[model samples]
Structures are given as structure tokens and as C-alpha cells.
Target: MRNVGAFACGLLFGLGLIVSGMANPAKVLAFLDLAGHWDPSLAFVMAGAVAVAGIGFRLARTRSASILGAPMQLPTARRIDPRLIAGALVFGAGWGLAGFCPGPALVSAASGQPRAWLFVAAMLAGMALFAALERLAAVRAQRSQSSS
Candidate 1:
């Protein structure tokens, strides 16, 4: 039942992306372009998304569990640390360059877009690399603690 609910939600999200032209790289690039024929349509979409998410978060804050009876694991981090800043920069760079963030990239890839496939592959590689680097850092920290 949980899996079914998750699938339904994901399918709906993908459909929304497609309907909103978010899954189209050209549309996204046009939206990003500021000086040359800038398209502000995506800005409206983004604003709507932000508004909806804000309301959803506000409601979720009052709940202990999700509708699926699972624990509500919302983000707890509030401080804007260097790591967060760096991550935001990296994410923005990727989005600007490829015109496809993770969600839209996945939707495009599922629709058999070649560029989206490449983007998804690169994204996965970056995630894997980040995981490996984190593991290495953890090991170094553990060793340093043991030596101390």
C-alpha cells in the first residue's frame, strides 16, 4: 500500500512536470535566458510550486505522521552553512548548464530523451562521487579520533 501510494505520487509529479514544460530542456533554457527572449512562464510555475510547498510544510509541521502512517521526516537544518552554500551553487550551475534538474531530468529520461539520459548519468556519477568522498572523510575522522 505504501509502495502504491508512492508510485501514484511519483506518477502524478512526472505528469505535472511534463504538463508544465519543465521536462523540456529548450523551455527551461529559454526561461533561464535573461537577455535574449527570456521566458517568464517558468517563474510563475515556480512561484505556484513554492506557494503550495509552503502550505504543505506548514500543515505537515502540525502532524506527527504522514498520511501513509509513516514518520514525518522533515528537514531540520536551518543554518546556511558553507556546505549548503556550495551545494546550492553546484545545483544552480548544473541546472543552468543542462537546463534540467533532477526531477525534470528523470521525467525527460523516462520519456527517452538522449540529453536527459546523459544528464541523469552524470548526476548519478556526481552523487556516487559525493558518497565516496563522504565515506573517506568519515574514515579519516574516525582514525584521527582513535589516534587522539
Candidate 2:
């Protein structure tokens, strides 16, 4: 049941990407190109997405928990630390270089864009780096506990 629901949701998301012209790397690249031939259609699409998600999140906040699940796992950390800054910098640079972010990269993976591969590669590298950092932090925490 869960697998079926997940598959359906993924299918809908992919269809949305296709419908929004987000699955085309050239379209994305053109939108990001501010010099010669800048296409602004993608900006509208992104604004629509932000509007929808913003309203949805606001609605969700009014509820204690989802009907089918527990309370949303919202991040509560408010500190602006070095890790956050570094991660944001990396993400921004990768987006500028690839033009297609993670959502579009996954959608266009079926289209065989070389730049899409680079986007996915960098995305996975970021995730792997996060995992390694988390492991190191755990080790350091354990060492401190033992020393104390």
C-alpha cells in the first residue's frame, strides 16, 4: 500500500516536471542565462510552486498531525553555524553551474543530459559529505564522553 502510494506520488511529480518544462535542461539553462537570451518562464513556474508549498505548509501548521501520520518533523534548530553556510554556498554554486537543481535533475535523468549527470554527481557528493561529517561528529562526541 505504501509502495503504491509512493509510486503514484512520484509519477505525479514527474508529470508536473514535464508539464512545467522543468525536465528540459536547455530550458533551465536559458532561464539562468541573464546575458543574451534570458527566458523568464521558469521563474513563473517556480513562483507558482513556492506559492503552493507556502500555503500548504501554513495549512499543515494549523493541524496537530496529518490524518494519516504523526506531527510533521519540522527542523527546530535556529543557529546559523559554519556548516549551514558552507552547505548553502556549495548548493548555490552547484545550481549555478548545472542550471538544473536536484528535483529537475532527477526528473531529467531519463533524458540523458551530461550536465544532469554532473548535477546528480554533485548532489550525491554533498549527501555523502554530510554523512561523513555526521559520523565524525558522532565519533568526536563519543570520545568526549569517554574522556569525561
Candidate 3:
């Protein structure tokens, strides 16, 4: 049942992206191009998303657990550090270069576009690389602390 609900929610989200023209790279690129042919449609879409998410978060705050009986796990990190800034920079750069954020990239890939597939592949590779680097850093930190 939880899986079904998740699937439904994902379907709805993808549909929203498609309906809002966010699944199209050209549309997204135009939106990002402020000095050129600027598109304001994405701003409206973002506003709608923010409003919906605000309501959803408010409602979620009232619930102790999800419908699946699992406790909700929210982000606890509030501090901004170099890691966060670096990650955000990379994310923004990738989005700007590809004109497809993660959600839209996945949705676009469903259309069998080669570019979309390549983007998703690169995204996965980056994620794997980051995980490996984090693990290495953790091991090194542990070793250093033990030696001290």
C-alpha cells in the first residue's frame, strides 16, 4: 500500500512537470536565460510548488507518523558549511548546463532521449563518486582520531 501511494505520488509529480513544461530542456533553458528570451512560466510553476509544499509541510507537522506507520525523518542539518555550498554550486551548474534538474531528467529519460539518458548516467556517477569520497574521508578521520 505504501509503495502504491508512492507510485501515485511520483506519477502525479511527473505529470505536473510535464504539464508545467518543466520536462522540456528548451523551456527550462529559456527560463534560466534572463538576458535573452526570458520565460516567466517557470516562476509561476515554482510559486505553485512552494505554496503546495508549504501546506504539505504544515500538515505533516501535525502527524507523528506517515500513513505507512513509519516515522517521518526530516532533515536536522541547519548549519551552512563549505560542503553545502560546494554541493549547491555543483547542482546549480549541472542544472544550468543541462537545463534538466534531477526530477525533470528522470522524466525526460522516460521519453528515450539519448541526452536524458546520458545526463542521468552522469548524475548517478557523480552520486556514486561523492559517496565513495565521503566514505574515504570518514575512514581517514577515524584513523587520525585513533592515532591522536
Candidate 4:
């Protein structure tokens, strides 16, 4: 039942993205373009999303567990570090270039668009590379600690 609810939620979100023109890369590109033919429609969508998410977060905070009886696992990080800034820059650049963030990219890929497929492929490759690099760094750090 919980899995079904999760699936329903995902489906609703994808549908909302499609309906809001968020699944369209061109629309997203237009939204990001400030000096060019910019579209401000997505700003309203984003505002609505943020407002709803804020309300949901407030409501969720009142509960110890989710509707499915599972404890909520939220990020506890509050400090903005170099890694966070770098990651935000990378993410913003990726979104501006590809015009597709993770959720919208996945939704767009369902439409059989070549651009969407390429974006998803590159995104997966980036994720894999990052993981590998992090693992290597951890191993090096552990070895250095043991030697010292």
C-alpha cells in the first residue's frame, strides 16, 4: 500500500510536470534565458511548488513518521561549504545547458526524445564518476590516517 502510494505520488508529479510545461526542454530553456526570449511562467510554477513544499514540510514536522509509518529521513546539513557551492554551480550549469533537471529529465526521457536520452545518459555517467572519485578519496584518506 505504501509502495502504491509512492508510485501514485510519482505519477502525479510527472503529470504535473507535463501539464506545467516543465517536461519540455524548450520551455525550461526559455525560462532560464534572461537576455533572450525569456518565459516567466515557470517562475509561478516554482513559486507554487515552494509554497506547497513549505506547507508540507511544516505538516511533516508535526509527525514522527510518514503516512506509511516510516520515519522521515531529512537532511540535517545547514552549513554552506565549498563542496555545496561547487555542486550548486555544477547543477545550475547542467540545468541551464540541458534544460532538464533530474525529475524533468526523467519525464522528458519517457517521450522518446534523443536530447532527453543523451541528458539522462550523461547524468548517470556523471553520478557514477562522482561516486568513484569519492570512494578513491576516502580510500586515500584512510591509508594516510593509518600511516600517520
Candidate 4: residue pairs that collide: none
lDDT of 3 at 77: 88
TM-score per prediction, in order, is 0.98, 0.82, 0.97, 0.97
Shift of residue 86 alpha carbon in model 2, Å: 2.2
Better of 1 and 2 by lDDT: 1
Candidate 2 residue pairs in backbone clash: none
Segments in model 3 whose C-alpha atoms lie over 4 Å from true places:
none
Q: Rank the candidates by lDDT, best first.
A: 1, 4, 3, 2
lDDT of candidate 4 over 1-39, digit per residue (tens): 999989999999999999999999899999999999999
**Candidates arranged by TM-score, highest first:** 1, 4, 3, 2
Q: Candidate 2 residues 1-148, lDDT tens each? A: 6577668878988899989988887787788889969999999999998999899878887787764566676567899999899878877776667767788898787678777787788788879988998999999999999999
**lDDT agreement with native, every candidate:** 0.97, 0.83, 0.94, 0.95
User: How many backbone clashes can be found in candidate 2?
Assistant: 0
- Whole-model lDDT for model 1 versus the true structure? 0.97
What C-alpha lDDT, on a 0 to 100 scale, does residue 60 get in candidate 3?
84
Comparing 1 and 2 on TM-score, the stronger one: 1
